[model samples]
Target chain A: MINLQPYENPMYFGYLLIGLLPIIIGMLYEKRFRWYETLFSFCFLVLIFDGPKLGQGIALIGYTIFEVLLTWGYVRYRTRPKGANKTSIFVLAVILSIAPLVVVKFTPLFDPQHPSIFGFLGISYLTFKVVGMIMETRDGMIKEFNILKFLQFLLFFPTISSGPIDRYRRFIKDYDRVPTKEKYLELLEKGVHYVMIGFLYKFILGYFFGTLLLPNIEKIALINGHSNVLGLSWSLVGVMYAYSMYLFFDFAGYSLFAVGISYIMGIQTPINFNKPFASWNIKEFWNRWHMTLSFWFRDYIYMRFVFFMIKHKVLKSRIAIANLGYVVLFLIMGIWHGETWYYIVYGLFHATVMILTDAWLRFKKKHPDLLPSNRFTKVMSVVLTFHVVCFSFLIFSGFLDKLWFGFR
Target chain B: MDNVRETVLEILSDLTGSDEIKANPDINLFETGLLDSMGTVQLLLELQAQLDVDAPVSEFDRTEWATPNKVVAKVESMQ
Candidate 1:
């Protein structure tokens, strides 16, 4: 049986307080600080304190504080009214947020013995959030920042780890004042439901599949050896299913817990999953699964790359450049996931599939009258997409080594 | 005679695999299922590529890209 005790980290309460500190600080400094600015400072301080080591913590906290202050200072120098210098602020924020990720990913080369870096808690998610906020501010979508509101927006605990990737504009508009007695009661009830579902998925379904089904199938494959080809094939397929189930249960569980907590707090965070397994194509699958992250890539990475390609006139052909952009975007995505050749290959694989699918659709469009509207095609697309995703996951899980090394 | 309209129409025709662009100037891209959110990104890229313009894709809200009229207006301004 899995141990629940490990989940109860002693620092858990401290982390919650750290998450809430920004809001409190923002409220207290309402006169001088924009609510969001105060919250940002609080978050910076918390991040510094929460660092794995004193030196690393001090450096990260100092860097973030300096960046935030520098950004605010630049805005102030412009002498523009509240939301006017949004573009400059956003540019600075993105650069600053991305700096930590770049340093961490590259640090392994310098210190191989201690490959792990310190002081980053949900840096990936924070980078996305900060970028999204800056973009929204630049677009003139958000006018004013309240410190408490800003803190609540940034450090909403549920999303701090493995986020549903909330956008700032959407979140701010959706968030209301904290709940009253009746509202709190309703939130508590819903929060309990979500927590129950999350716990069941993680403890029951995920654990059972990981412990029982995966091991049993592996054993069966080993016993049968190459003598029973059908058994081996079935075992591989079973392993894929187990992996897929584990991912869904794990992520969906986290999202449910986040949503439930937010709802009680009077925030209506958008639903993250929508039966992604039922998607009919790669395009549909992207729409359904990890919707927020996909959207982020679309908005910030893919679209920008496409625009840049068009602007530079480097490629004579638009379609060719667009296809290349997709590959580049996915490759960046792979690198973002981790520093591994497997990740790069996995990214390239998905990018190739997505590009080919898109090209096929384009071709079909040109000769539509020649094509038939058949259910078989749809079914085939769905099956192919699922396999593609599963294969990518296999690569992600570092299982291709087993295939190449003869299953020792 | 403006290539802007023709270019957009060609792109739309290619995307939807239908010659409906010539038939309707005021068709709702989303409601008619010609362009979902992904399609919108594709369309923006196509417009930038063909038109040689730098229209910020972020600024192209759904309401603005819903019809040919708005699309034409947005493209013209960017040019």
Candidate 2:
């Protein structure tokens, strides 16, 4: 009857560390305790989906079966001797992989109070994994289908709720081998460091920014902006910065916990953030912020879009094609976040900025003297990019919708 | 095979807009900022168009195709 959300509290880490000890010990002895690791993952998964969340647990089971079968089927088709790779079939498989997530995302629009039957925590992340697998299979990159390994990857407890989204091949390599003692010792050191940093970011700074400060700031902003013209006030700027900090600390902290725990288990799950605020441009920000997700969007969505455009000769100009790809990528990203106007706007805003940044870079290349590369310019770029990103975050935060139209 | 290498190096240079790819065939294109996700796409498209080497975008792994020499080898192997 015990239900636990991932990294929900200090107690979760206590349980996690205790559960990881056996695997850690086994790794130290140059053994991968796969059975025990599987057992630990199941137990933790149960804790996450038990009690009042039993429906979601059931949903997750059904969803896992569905994805596993879909991936297996696709791989089998692709790898079959004399199999003809049909575009329609590949497209259908990808669509099927995303169907549940689409339904889950759209459910709220139809019924505000009721959760979708297909919905589960981390469904989006799971969908990303399945879609990635399907795409790889299509590309002839994923030629083998191992159902058990697929299950393990999909159900990896540490990153189940959210992810630094591990790739199939990258994950399997780590899963199949026990790291050398020295390497594991290093992993242990870094893992411990990351978890400690996560604690500071999530429990301390995240708490201070999100829990302690956000509500008060929001209240003040609402009060001051409610009567102001177009509900605009300086207090809203306070809301923007506070929300941005909270978003970064809270999510980055959660990501660190995921990555650290994966490290402890001998899986080198990718890091999600890399000093994102230091980015000099919107394009660079995507590279640093929630890196795995952005990279996913980049590789699977953006790159593919550009390739499709070029292959089909949809646009004559490469620049125009690149610009259109950004629009398509960000628009899809926005819709994936949810069916909201602000989210769409946030997507378009990023798309426009990315295009402009590309144009500026090209122009700067053409006229290097106009914008000299100095420390001052570098600082200015970062400062400007940070505020631009913060403004996007404000739009993402949905405070504006509330400020303007009183919808939270 | 030499033609494949030369062609791939030319494509890399064109896509990156830098002759450094040819100058240092072993340089990490990704790490050195010479090639990126978009650049990778362009490279694949150019390769497909020029050499008739049908390398899918998804098959373009960074680790496997990190350098001009490796890319040339990959193209040759595919051929």
Candidate 3:
């Protein structure tokens, strides 16, 4: 049994202070707080008290209340005639979505262990999805929402933990239609399969490979370096391949399990992956990989950035504009991932590679006759892209210090 | 001369990487696999660039541009 003594952590009192005060102030002033804004405040209170048990309880209660309020507010707001004022709402939603990310990402600098300031559990995913929904509503891509549905969307338990990054339209449409008994059975079966897959990946594959295989291989490579550069490179590549596969299965398995559970609960969630490794190009890989997250970025972030650039005359020259747009998009992406210089570098590295690859493809298309149509180029591009992706992952693992200091 | 049909067919060929445009003038773009959402965006950009006409992206209707014939007609009307 888990120890309950930690529940008495002083942090609980801090959370009580941080969580309740703003809520009271907001209520007194009748100022609206976005769902995440309210949750963040509560998380702060929990962090102050250092009571994980109390924090968890408060988080559950707080989220339920926030969901209900947001849902009700959404319904009431939707009843008003469409107007130009939606732009302000969209902007507000964007800021609220990005706020938690900023706080959590930066918190490691102040307190690296807990990082409770940002409220890690599902806040990032929910914030992005909520922001996307607001954007979709403003863009007229989705019909106005009702309160209960909105609440359900926010606090939908299966996806609340780890998401397939559902879209508002898809979620609402599926929610409105009740699934048949047969469908429930089918979904339950799928859910079980997903749970099994998640367990296998997380416990068997990820743990075993990471603990049993990687360290020994690394040790061998370290001892024989320089004399066995090729061997070391190949081994490193193998390790990366294992890491990449582990990450995909672990995350994707969680998403699949979430979707399966939701499906069994009579909510039809969208699939998040479609054989990303089979992709022929980086663009295709992105399209097939972490589809929901990428789509969220595309719909709400990338497209918005592109439109802003176009409107502001920042995209005057083709090459300059493409590069600039990519940098901006990836920088935001980096910030979204975390506040560390490592993530920033990770984002910039991808942006640079994507831009250069795009430029090269454009050039090749323009001068088809001059370009080599050999199998070697195609093979090389795939190999190079894979290595580039692996290197980025290394930076993400926070092992740059080790790389620099030669410390094992 | 079938100017609208010819222009659309040429554009479709480029997009689908096909020499022949098998799509019917009245068929839905989605039904014919001629356009998905990404393809639709690409088509819009191409149309704006090639025809020097502004299409309000905000007002884009899937049904209105569901077919090459409808798209061509829309462009012609705009012209």
Candidate 1: where are CA atoms >4 Å away? A1-67, A70-93, A115-117, A136-149, A176-196, A215-234, A369-371, A402-408, B1-33, B36-55, B60-79
Q: Across residues A1-408, which tens digit of lDDT does each residue of candidate 2 receive? A: 778889987778888889988988998999988789989999999999999999999999999999988998999999889976999999999999999999999999999899899899999999998899898889898999988899999899889898879899889999998899999999999998899899899988999999999889899898898686777788889999999999999999999999999999889999999999998878779889999999899889988888888889889898998989989999999998989999999999999999998888778767859977799999999999999999999999998888788853
CAPRI-style docking class of model 3 based on DockQ: incorrect
- Clash pairs, model 1 backbone: A35-A146, A35-A147
Q: Which lDDT tens digits does candidate 1 get at residues B1-79?
A: 3788888888887876666666886888765556754466667778877897665566766677788766887788878
Better of 2 and 3 by lDDT: 2
lDDT of 3 by residue, A1-408 (tens): 122221133453244335445533443343424464436533443443344455544554554465445534543464466544366665765565556556656787788787563363666677777776656556555556666566667666556656777777777777666455555556556755765675676556766766677677666554554454233455566656666766776677667766655654445787787777765456656667788787666656665565555556665764565567668777888877887778899889878877877777666667769857578876776676666676777666554434344643
Which candidate number would show the highest lDDT if scored against the true structure? 2
Model 3 interface DockQ: 0.19
Task: Give the lDDT of residue A273 in candidate 3.
Answer: 79
Model 2 residue A353 CA deviation in Å:
0.5
lDDT of each: 0.64, 0.90, 0.61
RMSD of 3: 9.8
Q: What residue runs in model 2 are displaced by over 4 Å at the alpha carbon?
A: B23-34, B63-70, B73-79
